[model samples]
Target chain A: MSGAGHHRNAELQARVNRLLDLAESRGVITRGQVDARIEAFGDRVTARNGADMVVRAWNSPEYRERLLADAGAAAAELGHAGGGYSSDIRLHAVANTPTVHHVVVCTLCSCYPLAWLGPPPAWYKSEAYRSRVVRDPRGVLREFGLVLPNSTEVRVWDASAEARYLVVPQRPPGAEELSEDAQRDLVTRDCLIGVAVPRLPAEVSR
Target chain B: MSFAVGDRVRVLTMNPPGHNRAPRYVRGHVGEVVRLVGDGRFPDESAVIGDAARREDIVTVAFAGPELWGPDSHTGDRVHVDLFVSYLEAVGERSDGGRTR
Candidate 1:
């Protein structure tokens, strides 16, 4: 016995349809263009773009200096030029050192570097992560299987503005023996976000 | 720009209507401008106007844990938030004194 008391879903659908029609009529965007853009984003952009930047920085001190200085330009050097959605948006890189760890979050909204890092993960957009990270970063990192020593300072970066953040995890031990591609594989999205650090496959196996 | 790098400033506790990028947590908090983050479209305006919004200067503000929270907070812990220039105010001697959150 379904009641007609609330047509919330239907009403929302109709509103969405109306907005789509209006946008199409005004040439704001076409369905084909939208689909094409999504497809391009899925195909060309991925976390690998960010991993490439990290791997390059880990190997080259000059690249690391440039990345820490002008992250947007450093990304562009690797052909990951962001700033499509907002003409003024920039990418900022924070490097993790022996004594400090950097983690990023957008408390107000999911203002991620989608152009460079691809779409944000489901967990990233969740309210728990958004609200909890700023309040209890160390606990959140610990829950994520990352336990930091008391001496290591945790720097929580609240990306509340247009500038997006990328965390460069500290280079792992014995990483010098790894090839460029192998090193790239070590740097995952979580490593870039500072929730987890890169580990050699052997380390994980052991 | 109203403030430069190394300038000690306080984030304005403004509750402007409509969209805003200044997070509620950092409002009225004292922090130092670490670096100029370049100019960007103001979120309060761009959140309404997609492409026509004017750009404004942005800076990465760093706040100590004890300052943002309290004495109970971790001693060496620091938090950094990128903020627009307009959201920051110049601090004078003892300007932040007697201003209780």
Candidate 2:
């Protein structure tokens, strides 16, 4: 970044630090709690958690059924309970089929399934993406290097409420041949957001 | 629940000057209630009255892409928006906010 931009960011960080100190001293919030939350977001809660659930669903039909029925309960079943600010928040998984593609966005704000998918990409919060995805999802996906066939049905989930969405990308060809760990590696954060799909290394050529 | 799954509902067009959860794009638009997402504290009033605001039902409304963006929207595409119960009414129901809210 430019020197001026770096200086501006440092100034903003110092202001946030002052606010944190004031909040801590006033007993409004504890430093330990703040640290724990940051730690959770940075490490404990991540897209790998979503990948774990997806891999389990791919391996077992019963688990997949359970996930679709009650995604919150299913996440807890896999020990990846959607933990964050509110217990009222619900996670809904939308699976991608050969003829159907499911993408998620919160037009008003970036209400993401962060507990499962980790932090949202910067572009997910951009005005261009937030507005256009709901309008021309297929076109935006094309920009993301995902070109769905004209016949495919695109479903854009606008998470304007408490219900957070997770896109269960279809396991790619040759994915079944890979081990469980290999399969999880394919399900990146983008895959979980429905911007892109998981693919085997060999399939990259297509 | 005021609305059941698969019911055709239309979002109310009333523009409350307070914090409204119903996005402008969906106001006065018609969609199908796909899921009954259990109620939460009503966001609009809660924004003004705080937590004391009554909890109300919310549902997933799936609108056809064409209905939202007209010709620019691709065929066979849809946008599903989660809307509070107060912001919706039965398709033929009068578009009066007082009746629902």
lDDT of each: 0.85, 0.88
Worst 10 residues of 2 chain B by lDDT: B92-101
Clashing pairs in model 1? Answer: none
lDDT for residue B42 in candidate 2, whole number 0-100: 91
Model 2 lDDT per residue over A1-206, tens place: 01123446778999999999999989999989999988968987789999999999999999999999899999999899977587669999999999999999999988999888888777888788888888889889999999999999999999998899989989898899899999999999988889999989878777
Give the TM-scores of the predictions, in the order they appear: 0.87, 0.91
The candidate scoring highest on DockQ is 2
Query: Which stretches of model 2 miss by more than 4 angstroms?
Result: A1-11, A27-33, B93-101
Clashing pairs in 2: none
Q: What number of clashing residue pairs does each candidate have, in the order they appear?
A: 0, 0
Residue lDDT tens for model 1, A1-206: 12232557788889988987888999998878878988998987888999999989988999999999999999999999985766667789999999999998898888887876788886887778887777777888898989889888989888888788999987899998989999989998888877899999998898
Best by TM-score: 2
Query: Share of real interface contacts recovered by each model?
Result: 0.78, 0.82
For all the candidates, what are their Cα RMSDs to the real structure? 4.9, 4.0
